[model samples]
Target: MKIKRVSEFVSIKRTVENGTDEQLLAVKAIIGNVKKDGDSAIRIYTQQFDGASLESFTVTVDEMAEAYGDIDKEMVLIMQEAAENIRSYHQKQLRSSWMTTEENGTILGQKITPLDSVGVYVPGGTAAYPSSVLMNVIPAKVAGVERIVMVTPPNQNGKIPAAVLVAAHLAGVKEIYKIGGAQAIAALAYGTETIRPVDKITGPGNIFVALAKREVYGDVDIDMIAGPSEIAILADDTARANEVAADLLSQAEHDERASSVLVTTSESLAQKVAAEVAKQLAELPRKDIAVKAIADFGAIYLARDMNEAVKAVNELAPEHLEVITENPMELLGKIKHAGAIFIGRFSSEPVGDYFAGTNHVLPTNGTARFSSPLSVEDFQKKSSIIMYSEAALKENGAKIATFAREEGLEAHARAVEERLK
Candidate 1:
């Protein structure tokens, strides 16, 4: 990893901006073809990309039952525990439709309603993230989404991972489809003969999947165009360099594009953490990927003081932030942006990713400045409720009519005028 003085590295940009027009055009072609040709387009793309010839895309009911039997008992228990924690966390976010009446006989409020159906796409290739299933589906279930559909790639043997199946079952997914990549996104957005279109699609996948989601966003809602996993550590001399190095490597191992950065006030601590990262990297199974990530996107910066380090972190706005200092809480008031903040040495990124009872699907690539982690709100829609009594209309209708007329909308003015009469 490269080490630089904080003053010099403070203005670093994380990832490149969004994709170019050519990339968007390719995604658009895929979406349009899927919308036009339906299942035939899906089959062609699936065979071309996933190396699997599917006689059918949707998983059979019996297959789901078989998955449960195939999975290990111990793994099943772990998934159950994770599901319960995820459910408990999201249950607090559940909202109900409500209304309030005034003495003037006007009722004004908002109604919360879950979407009819949602689609979740899980990446399948080198790994299967059962945790992702819990993160995506539990929030939808909590929001009362009627039907939750899942899409994942099948292995060359045409079998989904047992853990993936078990996680889907625990999260209350209604259907699972053996499909992946842009084609799977197309199938979800447009719906094939076997697959029904969903109101929204959630979860993460590759660049093709991200581009597909970006392409199909207007047709169906998506959680966000997640870029890559990232973690930033803000530490002081008080922090243990070994622990900080390990935490950074945890995110670095995610992918070659993932970023792991460290900003500290003490130059000595920076040097120690750099040595620790090199030592830990040798032992990591995914060391090559982590090394590339650290080489390209990761860094250790020597800030002049804690405030400078905090400023650099806020500018980076990493998906995960770890503050390990003598007084971690003291910096919390200074932090204006971050997807999730991990305070103290023990509160590492993985804790929040797994069992911390907080959603791990976070904003990436500086999006934490405005976007939020996936939650129950992503699955539910809100509608404004407005009811005015005759007297109330008489009181406010003129203002409404005047405002509408000022905007040169005659129909709007007439509607209010007739109501008043």
Candidate 2:
């Protein structure tokens, strides 16, 4: 990791803003072909990219039973525990449909309804992320989603990961498919002969998956166009250098494009943390990925003071923000943008990623500036409810009519006028 002065670091833009239109176009073409050609396109893409010859894309119930038998009992227990924690957290975010009526017979409220069906895309290319299975499915289940379907790429042997199957079973997902990438996304967005269409899609994948979601946004609801994982640490002189370095490396090991940055006012601390990172990288199993990530996107900035450090963090709008200052609580109010905020030395990123009972599927690529972490709210839709009595309409109808007429919408005014009469 290289140390840069705060002035220079502040002037540089975060990497999230540099998306290419070429990638978007390529993704759009893939999505279009899949939507138009259906399973044929899916099969061709699956064979071309995944090197699998699949007779069907859907995973059968018999295969799920086989997966359960193949998986270890201890792993099942762990998945149960993680699923319990995820369910408990999302249960708090469950909302009820409500109605309020006044004495004047005017009723107004909102109806919260769970989506009919939702699709979860779990990546099977690199490794199985059973954690993501729990995070995505539990929220929709808690929101009362009727049908929760999961799609993941099958291995060369044409089998889903046992861990994924166990997690899905724990999360109450009855439907699982052996398909992935842009084809799976297209199948979810537009129904194929075998795969049922879904109302929404959620989960993270590579650039191809992100681009496919961007293309299918109009067809169905999507969580967010997630980019690479990133973590920004704001530490003061009181913070430990080794601990900060370890936390930074935790996110760096995720991918080669992942970013880990540290902003602090202490010059000695910066040097110490950089040295500690070098030492730690050697011991990590994913050292090559971490080293490349650190070399390209990671940085340790020496700020003049804590205020400057916080300012740079806010501008960065990182997916994960760690404040390891002596008084992390005091600076909490100053943070304006972050997908998830971890305060103090004990609150590490993996805590939220695993057992902390918060969703780890957070906004990335500085999208925390406008987006939010995945929650039960993503699985539910709100419909406004308005019921005005004759007297109530008489009282407010003229105002509504006037507003409509001012906007040159006579039909809207007449509708209100007719209702009042």
Candidate 3:
């Protein structure tokens, strides 16, 4: 890891994945075939990509029961508690439909309505992420979505992971499908013979899945085009170098493209953390991936002062930010841009990822500056409410007509005038 002055540091720029021309053509073909052929197209693609031959895509009650038997009782209990925490946290974000009425018999407000259906894609290849299942589904459930569908690739044995299925059951997902990749996204957006089309899609997947999401965005609403995981730590002399190094590696092990950085005022701590990262990197099971990530994207910036350090952190706007100063809370207001902020050494980044109530799905690659973590609001849509009484329209009709005609909207002007008459 390079140690440089904050003034000389530059945050790396990352755009949403634009697949190669060949991949784009491939995705388009897959989407077209799924739209045209429906369930048969999905079956062919599932066997070709996932190496699983399945007669039916739907998950049955027997499979759900077997999934519970596959995992231990303790693990189920843990996920149950985690689900409760997630549900409780997101419930706080729920908003009710509201209206305000005036004495003139005019009413104006907004209506909040949850989407009718949603599809959540859980990646299933090298690793199984039950956590993602919980993270994606609980919020939609909290938002009162009536139908929630979950899709994942089947293993060579033609089965979804037991843990993933257990998580889905715990999160209140009723519809589960054994399909993945771009075809799964297409099925979610356009619908197949068996699977119903959803109003929105959320969750993460491989490059093909991402490209498919980009391809189908306008047709059905999407959460965001996510980038690799990222973490930035702002620590002073009071912070422990080993603890900081461990936290950085937690994100680095996720992928070779993942980034872990440290910005600190103490030169001694900066050097020590670099050494600690090297020491810890050697012991990790995913050392190959973590080493490449640290070599390419990891760094330690030596700020002239705490103010300079905070400014640098704001410019980076990483997905995860950790403050390890003596008084971490005191610096919270000074920090402006981060998907999720972990205060004090005790509040590690992984706490929010697993056990804590906060959503693990967050903006990445400097997107935290403009976007936010996924929440209940992502599953709900808003409609403006307008009820104009005869007297109210009589008073405002002329002004409304004049404003519409100013924009050359003669039809709009006449529509308002018709009400007045």
- Candidate 3 local lDDT, 1-421, one digit each (tens): 7898998989965555788999999999999999999999999998899998899989999999999999999999999999999999999999999999998999999999999999999999657899999999999999999999999999988899999999999999989999999999999999999998999999999999999999999999999988889999999999999999999999999988899999999999999999999999999999999999999889999999999999999999999999999999999999999999999989999999988989999999888999999999999999999999888999999999999999999999999999777
TM-scores of the candidates in the order shown: 0.95, 0.94, 0.98
Model 1, 354-379: lDDT tens digits are 87778999998888999999999999
Off by over 4 Å in 2: 11-26
Top model by TM-score, which number?
A: 3
Clashes of each: 0, 0, 0
Worst 10 residues of 2 by lDDT: 10-19
Error of 1 at 401 (Å): 1.9
Model 3, stretches more than 4 Å misplaced?
none
What would the per-residue lDDT of candidate 2 be over residues 1-421, giving only the tens digit for each residue? 8899888885223455223788777677778898788888888888888888898877778888898899899888877887888899899998898999988899999999999999999999658899999999999999999999999998877888888988888899988888898889989999888788999999998878877887789889999877778999999899999999999999999988889999999998899999999999999999999999998889999999888888999989999999999999999999999999999989998998988789999988777899999999999999999988878888889999999999999999999989776
Q: Clashes in model 1: which pairs?
A: none
Report the candidate with higher TM-score, 1 versus 3.
3
Q: What is candidate 1's CA lDDT for residue 295?
A: 90
